[model samples]
Target: MGIDFLHKAYVRPSTYTTCIILTFMDQITYYGGLFFMTWATFERHLIIFHSAVFNTKRGRILFHYLPILSIFVYITLYYISVDFFYPCENHFNYLAFWCGFICYMNLPIPTLLGIELIAHQVVPMILIGIFSLALFLRVIFSRQRLRQSIEWKKYRRMIIQLLSTSTIYLIFTTPFSLNPIAQAVGLPPMFTTPVYAKVSTYWTFGVPICVPFVILLSLPKVKEKFKPLLKICGLGRVVPTR
Candidate 1:
C-alpha cells in the first residue's frame, strides 16, 4: 500500500504497466483478504463443531486444506485473467489513484464485475458476521452444558482470533463494500460517492495496518520472533521486567 502511495503521490505520468501492477495488487490484496478471512471465520465451525470430520485424511483434505487452496488458486487465476489478459484499451490518469480507472469499467462487462463484487465482497461480509457470532454462541452453550467438547485452553487463540477478525472486518470493510452497492442501486452519484473516494484512499492502508499487528499479537512467542530483527537494528535488548 505504501509503495503504491509513493508511486502515485510522487511519481508523475505513471506508465500503463505500473498502473497494471498497482491496480491488480490493490484489487487482489483488498478483495483477497475479505475472501480468505471470510472462509477462515466459517472454518472455525469445522474446527470446533465438526472435529470428527477431520479425523480421516480424506476428511482433512476435503474440509480444511482443499478450500484454502481453492481460494488461493481462484483469486490468482481470476485476477490474472482480468488484469493481464482481458483486452481493453486503458487510458492512464497519472493524477489519479491507480491510474484512475479499472479497465473493465471502459468495457461493457462492468456489470459482470459487479456480480463478482457482490459475490466476493458483500457475501463474504455477511458470512463473516453470521459465523463469528455463531462461534461465540456455540462455545458458550458448550461451556454451560459442561460437555467439555473441546479443551478451551488448548484452542483459546482460535476464539480470540475469530472475535478479533470479526471485529476487524465488520468495522473496517463494511463501508468499502457498501460503496459499490450504493452506486449499484437507484441513487445520485454525488451523494455518497465523493466520501467513498477519500475513504478509498485510506482503505488501502486499513487492513494491512490492522492485520499484521493482529497476526503478530496472536502468534505464540511473538517477541522471540521480533527480537533478532530488533537487535540487528540496534534496538535495546528485549528483557523481562520483574
Candidate 2:
C-alpha cells in the first residue's frame, strides 16, 4: 500500500498484480488474526478458569492443538474458495488497502451482506468481545472460589496479555472492519468513504504491524531478549547468570 500512496493504485488501472498480493495479504492478516486472536482469548479463559482442560495430553490436544489446526485449515480453505476460485473474475486495485474486495460486490446482496459481512466478519468480532468480557468476569468470580485458587500472578499475566493485544483491535482494526460493514448496511459512502480513505493509510496495515510487537512486549521472554541487546549497546546493566 506504500506504493498505492505514492501513486493512487486503488483507483488506477493495470494494477492487477499488486491487487492480488495486497488482497491475499490483507485477508490473511486481518481475517486470520480475527480467528487466531478470538481463539487465543477463549483459550486464556480455559487456562485461567479451567486449568484442568490442559492437565492431560488428550485435553491439550482437544482444547489446544485441534483448534489451532482447525483455524489454520479453515482460514486457508475459506480464503482460497472466496478469493481464488469463486466464480467472480479478478478486479485488482493493487494500490488499494486490500487491493479491493470488489469481486465480492458481484454476489447477490443477501449473500454478500449476510454471509460475508455478518457471518465472517461480525461473528468473529462479537466473539472477541464476548470471550474477553467472559474471561474477565470469570477471573473476578474465580477469586472467591476455594477450588479456583489460581495464583494472582497467572491471572495478572493473562489479563495483561489479552488487554494489551486487544488495544490494537479497539483502536485500529475495528474501524477498518466496521467501515465496510457499515457501508454494506446502507451507511452512505458519502460520509464514510473520505474519512476511511484518510484513516486507512495509518489504520489499514498498522494493526498487523503493531500487534506482534505488543504481544512480544507483553511477554517476559521478549523483555529478557531486549535486555541482552540493550546491555551490549551500553543502554542497560547486564544481569548476572543465576
Candidate 3:
C-alpha cells in the first residue's frame, strides 16, 4: 500500500527519488506476487494430492522457500539489467495517472516487453491454471468414504475458493497483461489518454484489494477467531434476552 501511495504521488518533483524507490518496489511486488501465486498453486496441489511428499522438510524447503528465493534473485537481476539499460524516468503527462510516473525501458521495447509478458503474465497464469485444475480433479476423484466428513468438506470448500480467486486474478489482470502487446507491435499504446489510463488502471489494483478479502472470507476458522475481537469492539454483538 505504501508503494501504491508513492506511485500515485509520483507527480511531485520533490518525490522523484521516492518514485524511483517505488518503481523498484513495484517490480519486486509484481513479480513476487506472480512467483508466490505460482508456488501457492503448486503447494496446494501437493498438500491435497500428495501429502506425503509435501509434508517433508526437504520437500517444503525445495518446493516452497527455494522457489521464492529464486524468484527474488531472478527479478532482482532482471530489474538491475533494466536499470543499467534504461534508468527510471518520471513522466507527468495527462496520462501519468494511468500510465504511471515511472518509465522503465524505452530502447529495447519489443524484446523486454515480450520477455515480461511471457515471464510475468503468460507463464505464471498458465502454470497456476494447470495446477489449480489438477487440484480440482484430485478433489473430485479422491475416495468418497470420507466425503461427508467435516475436514473433507473444509478442504473441498477451500479448493473451490482458491480456484475462484485464481480465476478472478487471471480475469482482472488479462487486460493489463495484453495491453503491452499493442505497444510491442506498434499499435496505438493502451493508455493514449488519461481517461483510458484511468479506466485500465483499476485492473491492476483489483488483486491488492480482492485477494486479502477473499482469503479472510474463505477461512471459517479465521472468521471465528475474529468474532471475539469484533465483539469486544462492539463490531460483532449478540443481544442477551431474559
Candidate 4:
C-alpha cells in the first residue's frame, strides 16, 4: 500500500523532472566538488573565526553570502564544463589543436605528445593529491578543537554527521577523479581487473538516495514535526506536536 502511494507520487512529470535535475546537479557538483570543498572549508574557517565578532547581523550576511558564492562558482564551472571540457559536436576542440596538428602533420610529435600527456594526466593527479591532503589536515584540526571544547558533547554528533557526509562525498568523487588518470596511463580497465566502473557509477549516484535517508533516520521528530501540518490539511489525524 505504501509502495503504491510512493509510486503514484513519483509518477508525476514534475517529480521526474526534479529527480533528473537533481541527478544532473549532483553529478556536476561532484565534478566540481574539489572547488566547492575549498570554498566550504574557507567558509567554515570564517564562521569559526567570526563566531564572536559577527553577531546575528554579520553572521546572517555571511550565511547568505556562502550560498550565493557557491552558486556563482557552480555557474562558472558549468560554463567551463560545457564550453571547454566537453565541447559540442559543432564546436572545435582547441584543447586538441596541438595534438591534432602533431599527429596529422607528423612534425616532431614525441615531445609534444609527452607534454600533452603529462598536462592531461600528471598535473591533475598532483593537484588533487595536494588538495585532498590539505582538506584532511583541516578537518583533523577542526575536529580536535571541537573535541577539546566544552560544547564537545553537544557538537559531537553533528561533527560525526559532517564527517560521514564528507566520507560519502569522497567515496563518490574519488573514483571519478582517478578513473581518467588510470585510463590515461594505460592501466587495465578498472572493472575487468577486479575493480568495476559500474560499481563506482552506482556508488556515485547512490549518494543522493543515501543522504536524504541518512538525515531522515538520524533526525528526531519525524512524525510530530509534520503531523500538525498534515492534520490542518485533513490528510490524517494529528499526533501531538513535539
Candidate 5:
C-alpha cells in the first residue's frame, strides 16, 4: 500500500507533509521489497542446495540480514545525496514529479536512466532468473542424487509456487521497467501514446492485485486458511438440491 502510494505521489500533487511521506515511503518500500525479495531467493537457494552453510549461525545471520541492512543504508544515503544534488523543493514538478527530478539531477540523463533501469528492472530480473534457474536445476539434480522420488515430492509444491510467482512478477513488471529504456532508445512514441500510459498504470498496479490470486492458486494451503474465514463470513456455503 505504501509503495503504491509513493508511486501515485509521482504524478499527484504533493504538499510538504505528503512530500515527506512519499520520500520516506518511496525509499523504504522500493528498496525494502527489492532487497528483501532478492535476498529471500538467495536464502532459498542456500537452503535447498547448500543446507550446511545455511544452517550455520554465521551464515544465517549474514545471509538473512546483512543484505537488507546494506540496502537500507544504501537507500538512505542515495536518497539523501540525490536530494542534496537535486533538491526536490528547488525542482518541483507537479506534472511529472519523479521524471522531472531525475532529468534535473546533476547526473547525465543517460546515466540516470541507466541507473534506474538497472536498479529497478535489469538487476532484479537477472537475479531472479539466475536464482530460479539454480533452484530448478537443484531439484533435478537432487532427484538423481537421492534416487528416492518421495524424498523430493514434499518440496514440489514449494518449487512450483516460487517459479510461478517469479514468472508472474517478470511478466507484469518487465514493460514498466523497460518503459524508460524504450524511451531512451528511440521509442519515445511508445510512451507518448495515451493508451500506453494507461496500460502501464494498470500493469504497475495490477501486480499486487494479481498476487493474492496467484498465491491462492499456487498454494492450496492458503486457500485452506482462507476457506474457514469465508465460511465465518457466510460466503462459503454450498447449495444442495433434493
Candidate 6:
C-alpha cells in the first residue's frame, strides 16, 4: 500500500510531465530526431568498423580518434559558416524557423543555422541517398560472391540487426530531409498536416527507445557480450559473467 501510494504520488506525474516536455521540445526543434538518428548511426558504424580492429592498441586509439576528428571537422565547418555564408536578415521566415530549429539544436547556432537549409538538410539527404543506393547495388551484385565467402548462418543475425537499425534510422531522418524541399516550395508545415505532427513526435521518442529494445531482442546476449567486448578492447576491466 505504501509503495503503491508513493508510485501514484511521484512516478506517474513525473513520467507524464517528462513526456509532455519532450514532445514540446521535439516539436520546437525540427531536426532533433534526425540529429539523434545521425549520432546513433555514427556510433553503430564505429562499433561495427572497429570490432575487428579494436583488438590492437593502435587500432583502439584510432577508434577513439574518429569521433574526436568528427567533432573537430564540425567545429571547422561552423567557423566557415559564420565567416562566409551569413544569411540575409529577411531570410529567416517560417520555413527558416523550422530549418533553424533543426540547425541550432544540432549545430552551434546562428552560423550553422544560416546554411542549414542547404548543407544540413539537402546535402545530407543526397549523400545518404547516394550511399544507400550504392550499398543496395553492392549487395545485389555481390550476393553470389558473399554466399561463397561469408558464413551465412553466423552473419545472418548481424545482417538482420544492421538492416533493422538502418531502416529505423532512415525512417526518422527521411521526414526532416524532405521537409526542407517542401518548405522551399512553400508547403505547409509537416506537423500542421493532418496527423503528421503527432505521429512524428511519437516516432521521435519511440525510435530511440525502440532501437535499444530491438538490439536487446535480436542480440539477446548484447549486454552480456558488450561488457566483455569493452574490456577486450581495453576500454575497461572485464566484469565477470555470472
Alpha carbon lDDT of each predicted model:
0.76, 0.71, 0.67, 0.47, 0.63, 0.49
What TM-scores do the predictions have? 0.81, 0.75, 0.71, 0.47, 0.70, 0.46
Q: Let me know the TM-score candidate 4 reaches against the reference structure.
A: 0.47
Tell me the lDDT of model 4 at 206.
57
Clashes of 4: 1
On lDDT, the leading prediction is: 1
Could you give candidate 5's per-residue lDDT for residues 54-138 as a string of tens digits?
5778987787667778877877776667644553344445545342343234354466645765675657766877888888887
- Ranked candidates (TM-score, high to low): 1, 2, 3, 5, 4, 6
Name the lDDT of candidate 4. Answer: 0.47
Between candidates 1 and 6, name the one with more favorable TM-score: 1
TM-score: model 1 vs. ground truth: 0.81
Candidate 6 per-residue C-alpha lDDT over 42-113 given as tens digits, one digit per residue, 9 for 90 to 100:
444445433566678887666566655665566455544542344522122222212222223344423444
| Count of clashes in candidate 5 | 0
Candidate 3 regions exceeding 4 Å error are 1-10, 84-95, 98-104, 143-151, 181-198, 221-242
- In candidate 4, which residue pairs get closer than 3 Å at backbone N, Cα or C atoms, i.e. clash? 190-195
Summarize candidate 4's per-residue lDDT along 52-111 as a digit string, tens digits.
535677666666566657756765565446433442232222222111121211323244
| Alpha-carbon runs more than 4 Å astray in model 2 | 1-18, 94-98, 106-108, 146-148, 180-202, 221-242
Lowest summed-lDDT stretch of 10 residues in model 3? 92-101
Tell me the tens digit of each residue's lDDT in model 3 across 62-166: 877888888889888877677445655545343243235445544355666567777787678778888888877777777475464325754666786788778
lDDT of prediction 3: 0.67
Total backbone clashes of candidate 2, pairs 3 or more residues apart or in separate chains: 2
* Cα lDDT, model 3, residue 216: 84
